[model samples]
Target: MGKTTVIHHAPLVGYPDDKLYTVRVIDGVIDGIEEEVEGKYINGYDKASVEEIDLAGKEWLSPSMIDWHVHTKLAALHSNRLNLSNCQSASEVFESVKQALNDPKYDTSLERNLVGINMRNSNWTDEDLFSLEKMNELSIERPIFLLYNGYHSMWCNSLALEVGGYGSSLNHKGHLVEQEAFDMFPKLTTANNQVVDNWILQESKKAAAMGVTEIVDLEMEHNIVQWQRRYAAGNDYLRIHVGMYTPHIQDAIDLGLTSGDDVPHTDGLIKIGPYKIVTDGSLGSQTAFCHDAYPGTKDNHGIYYYPPESLSEMIETGLKHNFKFAVHAIGDYANHLTLQTISKASSKPRIGSTIEHAQLLDIEKDLPIFKDLGLIASIQPSHLVDDRDLCHKFWPGREHRAYAFKSIVDAGIPIKLGSDAPIAPMNPWEAMAVCITRAGQGDEKNPFIEAEILDLETAWKASTSNGKTRLEVGDRADLCILQSDPLKLDAAGLRAMKVNGTMLGGRWTHKTF
Candidate 1:
């Protein structure tokens, strides 16, 4: 028989308050759960072979969380990049880069490029927007690449553009959007395997510390080989689902790889996730393919990365290859067109497909269609914290329908929460806080679209594995031990809740006990 491990006096979140719970596990699966009367005298497990942990009612236990949408590779790359999120204008960004160049840590040699990330130009005035001439003024010898906060645009200097094979005349402003930026991303951020692996390892440990047991890494590159290499190097803190893009679909099909197929040599730690396709741009980039133009523009309905027919063809092909689809749709028109494409595909996806970031929806129309289509909504609530002002500025008069979490739940659509890491922090607690309060971090007084705020229970469920609210028998032993009861906490308390330990398959990935 497998060794029995018993956890005693656990305060299970969302469970009965008057009773203490004892859970037993065998072979990394929950075997049984027993309720004990509060204050009852109980003896510890005395069996010679039994492993025991007595929480003594000092910790709250619940299912570990899952980040359904994240760009793991990009997150790792951004870990060391110069942060430009705090820069308010193009001049500030250039000044910050100039200062970083003087710092000994940043490399400015001709062979290497200086990279900065999280630049937001959505709220910047036209005069403050980045220009190629200004970028070239910094240095002609050193290449500079600045990634926007939304990951949909990049601002590069003349040398960087030359390195990326783009002529200066092609984009005088040095700004690349959508496919243009995506194509040049890896070229500028390429690093040795060992370096990237170390970065990913550090980021994985950070996720484990935050009680994240699983993540769907939707990095905009073919990730299987990279993940396999990482797993071989003992970087296995979290179970990862590696999502692929449309460009790699033919290769995946030719290799007979399907969605949910486990990569060899990883012991099920990594699996092929979905066939991801970006149908539109992002709100912060002012290119989300909205139904209406920006408040000041006429006949400008944003950009569509893929037309409806092209998207339909890709979905049909993916369905034939047994791949689940994850369509990136932010604006209402993008979501509407994605739904239409999926519904009209030649074949239906056998497994459940997901809409990545169904951010702005014609809620009254798309909610029912989304539910009827049996598609899951993979959302990153922390995006609202960042995009709140952008939504107000670019998408005025449609605030009520943006990031409508409560409405999605009420319509019976399965909603999963993530951080879209590197764009936002990969913290489930922060996501939950934002979802429950409809406010940004540390600023609950100014709630945006309060009518769409989710209840605490709904937000908690969205953050957990398979939306499980409580630990139960027959469940996997992926658990998170918390310093306090999340059920009794407000938004501030939830964001500040400390994690005592994290477990995966009965093994402690992180522990303070």
Candidate 2:
């Protein structure tokens, strides 16, 4: 049977249609799909006939991706904070700070000084903060805040330190600054709440155009009021799940906003998610909670964001309030501790429990427990490609335990994929490309455990929640239309596939135009 109709050619139909042998869509929805074969164009039905379209040279079609780990607000604020992060040496950071001081957008009248620096793969030190002579010249002046690429650690300059009253108490390594220091920084924008709320809406729309349908907003600040107002004002366009930051557990408990509350959305606006807790620092920083020293480091094994007992107490608090725990555990020891703590805290498994950034694992020892505990390994595959070298350099002996995707699959643990945007591109195809190829299409060595290169189906599931009721037909038509089938295409081909358009609940959220 043959027929001609306008539609983006995809490998499989997203929904079941037995009566129709083929579907032809005009913009994104089904315009006319022929049920019978051996059909040629008979343009009589003006209302039902689809416009002609040719999509013979494309690949991989699926629903829009759900990047479970993205920070829309933080992503927007990143550009605002770029003055400091793009710096390599302390001098460069200072120069950017000076430039920002002169920028009209930034106000200099604020009492507390707060600035952020972005650090990349370059080496950084406390002295980098200031040359000895420079420090002497700028002694006790204004506050300066420094941020690394990973957003896990920060450096506070001396002048800023005294004003914040953390003068000597803060560690010189620049890794010990707290939220008080973060707050001392100038706000990104001074507009009213509605203006900032509009900012979030604009960012969300941009994410939709990028093929991102869902994002896990892990903001600690309770801008929920802003979201509530914006949502009430008919500004909802994306599916947003928010992680209650670790520090704000008490506020969440006090507000009585328990986990799983379906908040307002102009179109299914907001969904409450897991309670976020940081178990340890990252591996590259040599601050991840590892049992062993980072190869040649002195006696340091990494710092815990909170004491073990405190972590357990926090998990218990979330468990009591019925909030799903989504703890960040990067190192083997940290992952082990987090698993043990959650197991000890709850007798029954929590449905939405997840371990964010399960970057490293003690495969033989830890994989089995994930299945036993029924936790979600919410991970970012792109990080493996970016951090492969660091994993090899800093974690020479533990290469086998790094990003062991196959091992997790073998252990029957359900793993969800995300890009952790602002850190990585928010594109799921790129991530799926990396997941299958293991070789980061850029310059990184392949981190794939060959045996663990997940099949395209699994990778697709990780990209978009494939097995759940949420993805079923008639739930919401939030999906992406791709030019080709992902599974049929090779790794490079998949990465190159074009996202033709996006739909959010049968509405065009993003179009080529």
Candidate 3:
């Protein structure tokens, strides 16, 4: 028989506030849950072997949170790599790179290239956008690659451009956008497998402490093999759904892998996730394929990666293989086009077809279509906290439709919240807080769009798996125990809420008790 455990005085979420409940777990599955009776627990088990935990009605229990979209490898890399997220200007970015070059701490690394991530060029002035001449002035011997915050653009020095075979494609400002930027990513991010693995493990523990139980890792690499290797090396703290990029779609098909299929040798902790495709760029990069032209441009409508017919064909092919689709569509035009493409790809409703970053939408037109087609909207609310000013600048009057969480929910569309980590921090509390307040943490009064703010309940639902609002019997014992009642908290309180414990498969992954 499997191990049995009993939890007493558990304050179950969504349950009545008056009474605390007792929960029973057997081999990572919830067996029973009922009103707690004083000292009346542990039935049908060896008294000595059955472990018991008493919450004393002090903690709140809810399903473990899920980050519906993430690039795990990049997130892991951010821990050790140079972070330019805080640099406000292009000159500041160069100065930081120069400082890193002179710093002895960076010289100890085995990595030959100077790789940096999370630079927001949108915030920089046009005059600050320097050319290769400025980069050359640094006299850097090693290749340098600086990634844009949204992962849609890259700024590389001459050495880096030549190394990535992007010398001929380099623009005046040494910036690469869309496909060129994506193609150069591997060159910049390459490191020893062991070092990468260690980074992943470290990030996993951090995620657990933040109450994350599962992540849909949409890293732009062959994730199956990467995860298999990690699992074999004993990294199993969090459940992972490994997603594939378009380039590896055929590789997955050849291996007979379908979405949600448990990966071999992962101890059921890893599963093959959706076939992910980036149909457009991001707002930060100003390449998010919108309907209206950018502020200065006459007819430039951002970048659209795939033609409509081609996208439809791709979806149709994946659908025939029993693979679920996750397309990245951020701008209004991109979202509209992707919805239409997915709708035309199949006559029947595609159950698990999701639009990742459905960030911008044509509310009147797209909301009804999104609901009717049974497509899920995977959004990252924390993005609004960062992109609120950018949206107003780039999207102008369409700010209301940007990150329209409540509007989507009101239109009866299933919405999932995520961090889009490596872009935003992977904190569900932050995401939930932003969703509820439509403002950044501690800045709750100045909401971006008051009409689109989500309620605490709706935000909580979006954070859990399949929008589960409450814990139930027979569910997997993947749970998060909090120090305070989340429902009673305001936006700031939610953001500051502390996790007392986290349980995965009936075992504690994080515990303060």
Error of 2 at 283 (Å): 2.1
Model 1 misplacement above 4 A: 37-46, 109-111, 126-129, 168-172
Which parts of model 3 have CA positions greater than 4 angstroms off?
126-128, 167-173
Give the per-residue lDDT of model 2 (tens digit) for 438-458. Answer: 777753245456666776778
For TM-score, candidate 1 versus 2, the one ahead is 1
Q: Please write out the lDDT profile of model 3 over residues 65-91, one tens digit for every residue.
A: 899998898888777778887898888
* Model 1: per-residue Cα lDDT over 1-513, one tens digit each: 676777889889889866678878778788878886654323454467777788888898899999998899889888778999987777788889999887777764322788899987656665355688888888888889988888888888999999899886776579888888888878876577788889899999999999989999999887888899999999889999889887777767777788888877899889888889888999987789999997788987778877778887888888778898888999999999888878787766655688999999998888888887888899999889888888888998998899988899999998889988989989999999998889987689889988888998888888887578898889988899999888888998988989988888878889897
lDDT for model 3, on a 0 to 1 scale? 0.85
Query: Which candidate, 1 or 3, would have the higher TM-score against the true structure?
Result: 3
Name every residue pair that clashes in candidate 1. none
Q: Residue 194 in candidate 2 has what lDDT?
A: 63
* Best model per TM-score: 3
Q: Which ten contiguous residues of candidate 3 have the minimum total lDDT?
A: 166-175
Cα misplacement distance, residue 370 of candidate 1 (Å): 0.8
| C-alpha RMSD values across all candidates | 2.3, 5.6, 1.7
Error of 3 at 200 (Å): 0.4
lDDT of 2 at 469: 17
